[model samples]
Target: MPASSSRLSSYRLPAFALALLLLLGVGIASVWGVSSLRTSNEWIGHTYEVINRIEVAERAIRSTEANARAYRLTGHPEFRSQYLIATHQVDTAHEALASAIRDNPAQHARVKRMREAAQAHLVELRRLFDLQELQGAEAARQATNSTLTLRQWNEFDTAASEMRREELRLLDQRKARSDRSATLLSAIVVLGMLLSGGLMISLMVSVTRENKRARRLELEARGAAHEMALSMAQVGELSKQRHELARYSGLLQSCQTLDEIVQLSIDTIRRLVPDASGRFYLIRASQNFHDSVASFGDHLISSPDSLMPADCWALRRGQAHMVSGEEARQLSCAHLDTGTPAPGITSLCLPLSAQGTSIGLLHVSAATDAMDHGSAVDELIGQLAEQLGLAIANLQLRETLRTQSLRDPLTGLFNRRYLEESLARELQRCERRNLPLSVLMLDVDHFKRFNDTHGHAAGDALLGQVGRQIQAGVRAEDIACRYGGEEFTVVLPELDAAGALVRAEQIRRAVEIATVQHLGQQLGPVTMSIGISTFPGDGLTPEVLLQLADATLYRAKAEGRNRVLHVSYDD
Candidate 1:
């Protein structure tokens, strides 16, 4: 055999040995887990028995007291017998609990106290019985109502409760211990998996190199081609799953509250992978992938764009990307630090797309390279991407829906409904947060005359184009709405009278300078008469704000056709 073949065979022997070692470890761990579970179950059962016995003792005490009272009043031997039987049960219960937790210090103390109290109570009660038997029952009963007997019964009840509480405490402690052990075991298993995977990857790489040295080029080529085919298949499956995951993620993001999003994200990811971490990366249209929305890992990168390899392989080549352990070391890659590429990061990056445009890549890692076993993991990543895509799309759709609901469909500006809702919300926020809010109500200049002259389609196109201009003119925080046909409203939060006036003038200037064209015909520039009002100055309430802004808009229209008017609270 050639030198390469000899080396390859030698490497395979060690690889097989490592595989066997791991198989043995997995078997032993499974057995250990089973034993631990059995022990935990026994502890739980023992604790429950202690609690049950304590309850029985309590019931017996109550029965004994009830029987003694009945025997005193009715002079019935049957009640007396029942009382004696009940009294005997207290001792039996104490014995059961003492036998169950004799080794436990806290449990022993509770059982000791309960047993002593029960013994004392039995002695005192028997004395009372003797007195009633020797003398008259009524005379003995009257004597039995003394503080001594009462105190003894109270002590007995207190001891029983103590026993019950102690048992519960022990149960909690045992459960917590079991939970910790299980968690530790899981961590160990995950660590072991990573170790085994690294060893296997190292062996494979060594064998491949040896084969090449031996000039067994055919075998080497076949092996490389097989790996490439498998990788491609994995990528295809990932692509399909990415679509599905995006839809689910979109649904999760639609919740009105943050708590819902958190819970949904967890559940969604859990379903995607049994024990996997998910990180959501948001980026701008820049090359660096700089912006990150949220991350869920210990060693999350501070900057997204700079962290990506500048070689541009990930973006330029749209392959389901992977970097092997050896390659990582050779390249001195950041991903291989911490004795592992970030947990769950065996490495795969899928590009995010929206409307056929690439947004960013969603990167996933696994505990070990072996977890990249087949196409299953890649497909899972694809599913996650799908959910994320749909989530983002839905959010955008929701925004559009909101715009449609609040805006005039023809004009593409905030609708009357949105105007009303925004006015109310802004008013309340201003009052509670002690911030200024303002509204501008305006009407198109001679809109009816324009419609008649140019036709409704031209007028509609004009409204749509003007709405875009109005949107472009305002800050993102400002909301512009179509109050109605030929009328519009703008709500500015944290703005005063002066600020509102400046914004209003800016909007008027932008509208005057902008012109609309339909079917290659210039329709000339459109303009609007504006009215402005400020919260607590113009009006404090929603209705008052609308009324003032509307009145100012009427005045501006009356004064001329295209002018801005400011309305004060008094005006």
Candidate 2:
């Protein structure tokens, strides 16, 4: 009995020790795997930042060059300030780029070459400035024709391009490595749980065969616990990512202007899809053109400025076109400027459509030719495009409705409703500023008889011509309205009685000399009667001012039709 007890005691110590050691090993392995994955994710984010900085440097340099040319030509002080600011930004951005790539020897060398070339280009720009100061603008212009400037720019461009390509290559490599690390982490956790369960069960079996049933149940329970913990962790992470996407999508939906929509979409989508470059094209239906309104990232597909409906295969087919892979090899879209696809870049043009109608195309460019898109990224881009299309379409409908309500159908002038609104607002404004506002009430002379002599169509044409003349003569801030049937009104702010009378005379004389032609017949010269009324001096309120002007207009017709009349308060 003593020997058997001793044997059991010896087995139990070694078994417990081994089980405890195995537990520690599993825990340590799991922790190491998770840490590796976190490190990889950080590196991937850094790579994206580096690539973005490189593109920023490219943009800054281009701006500097453009502003430098403008400053040399016009000698405008504002242009000089702009050139200085843009040049300063380029310097700051290059320094940032250099700092970002310090660890990489190859990248550091390329950035050095770019920096040297940029410095030389800036020196040449200053040379032009110095030349302009000593000599004239013509000499500066002659210096602008120097080959040395172009050569320096070309060298800088070449260096910048090489660095961009290298960064893109690094981005891909780092992304793959990050993905592998995440996969490895998950595998390690699962394997550790399995190993611990197996070891615990074997120890239970070796320690006692009589309690095998109970120990087997215990082993299964432990295994179930580990899996449950893992699943809960995964669920929590997925929920967090989903929450982020939902919040950003809500922001996209709330955007007001086309610019706001484009800027927000680019900012959010780039974070979700690293190393992506693309342009957003908005369809201008009035111009019958597809225009590039917004862009982000780098390596964009060069689509034309004025694109036709038939030019985009995506628009023609009513579907998205992937300009990479075998399916894309079938036909290139008309929007693309190339017959053959560029190497190491993936291009996709998805029509931004709402309901059953198409609006515009979203062209996405990937750094790699393979265009390997993760499911999450593809889903995000699709969601952004869908929301943007709906928002912009709604804005278009709203603008159309607003315009129709405010403009007259025949004369293309503001209607009475707009005139009333403008008058009320401008009166309040001018009253506060202590400025004068003038109202001109004018009518075509003998319109009833003229309409009967010509046809109603001719009268309408005559009214349109007068409306256009009034539009051309008034300041942009002034309001010209069709005051119903052959009558017109102009609301001119900051114009007193004297200025108003002068303007009314100009309109009266212009109408007296103008002749209208209908079909094969030429009518006699037309004439207008205009009455001017000034605010505070003639009348204060819009109602009083308009009434006074109308009364004066009647007096003008009574005295002589083709002359201007001023109805003063002192009268």
Candidate 3:
């Protein structure tokens, strides 16, 4: 052998030795990888089984709780069926978990102890349920304390905790083996470094760029979450405002009479969202929206006759009709031309409906929409209008019922019931106000003789004529009711003895002057006898006042009728 052949053979022997060492390392690493994989797979299977068992246990607990609530609420036989099903499911869950963990030596050793504790707790719960059914709610509540619930919860929690531990251990082992394999591969790669070193640097740059992008995305996600929270808070505030508006609407609905409804509606609008001035307009039988009723800045417009039909675009549209700038020139009204409401005024008009008919329009004037007034404001206004319309309609119904109950249909004057009610109310008012109230009782003289001579139809017409004359002679605040037969009574509020005498004389004179014409037959002048009595000075009670007035009326009759007489009552 030459020197060169000898040197090459030496190099080959060392290379073969290094290759054999690498092969042995590869074999060891392969065995470790297989062992780690088997351990991970086993942990996965065990974890799945544990999860399945826990799910079953949770299902059983939920079903049991539902059945318990149902049985407590209804106490039905069907609820017993559900309760039994739930208890069976719980037993199955407990048994399945126990059987699955039987092969695990450590688990098996501790399970008996766990099972004993669990069984003890379950028995206590069962006894508690029985006691609750037999005894009372308080005893049951005391039995279902935190201890038993926590113990049952702990059973699953402990098993899940052990499974998590085992799973994590296996994962760690797998990771370690995988890391070793990676390290060996890295070493081999380094041994061949010069060929792929530039590619590794490029890969590292791409990874760094990706990490920066992920951090930016996280910041953006946080910003979006904060914005969403702010929007949700604003929405919550809007919901609160809407609820407050609904309350105001309900308050508007409870008005007892038309006048009361008007006062309440005005007050509600003033108290809530008061920036806008509102007014209600009633359409006449002519189908024209006219400003018959209105309240402005704490003052009510009392001119029932002053209102007339004007072509208002707002009312015609049945929506918000706003006119600003030069366009307002076409609209003619003292409210618009004088600028009392100021310029740039926006008007929202809602149509009032009662019994499916458009009755009128309600107009609201606002300076700005930023007052939280927009379409939502318009809808609220509509609801308010609807409530008002219903209240007015109810008031009308009550008035009709009241008239039917207390008024004489033929004369449109108060009947006997009205006389009684008026007397009671006047007595109460006199007591409260500490004022002297008087009643004047009047009776038509020779009415029956007149009816006998002229006929019953003439007598009824004469009575209607007397009713109108009396209504016109008295103040609007006074109440007039027809007593039985030809007698009538008038409640003279705030009137004392002298005032009552003056009113009684005025009524007598008016009846003497009133002429009744029936079927073109001119009846002679009619006359009435009047009697007056003062309250408190006479008697505090309603019956006493009326009786004293009635006595005085009989005195007027005894004094040859058609005269006024003052009645006296014993104090």
Best of the candidates, lDDT: 2
Q: Rank the models by lDDT, top first.
A: 2, 1, 3
lDDT of 2 at 568: 63
Task: State in Å the error of residue 437, model 3.
Answer: 2.6
TM-scores of the candidates in the order shown: 0.44, 0.50, 0.52
Residue lDDT tens for model 2, 1-571:
3476557657776666776776777678778867876787778788889889988998888889888888777888888889889989989999999999999999899889888998888888888878987996688898785688788878888888888788788778878887887787677667766776776776666557536645777887998899898878756644554565676678866776778878877776666556777788877868476888877776455666557878878777877776653344467777776753566655777788788777887877775422453334455566667777887788778778998999998889999999999998999999999999999999999999989988898898888878887887788899999999988999999999898888877877777777777776777578888888898788889999999899999988998787788896344
Mind giving the per-residue lDDT tens digits that candidate 3 earns over 165-192?
Answer: 6645755675676567666655654543
| Position 90, candidate 3: lDDT | 71
**Which candidate gets the maximum TM-score versus the true structure?**
3
Q: Please, what are the lDDT tens digits per residue for candidate 1 over residues 330-396?
A: 2323422444444434655555656765455555554444346454666666655655555555565
Full ranking by TM-score: 3, 2, 1
Pairs clashing within candidate 3: none
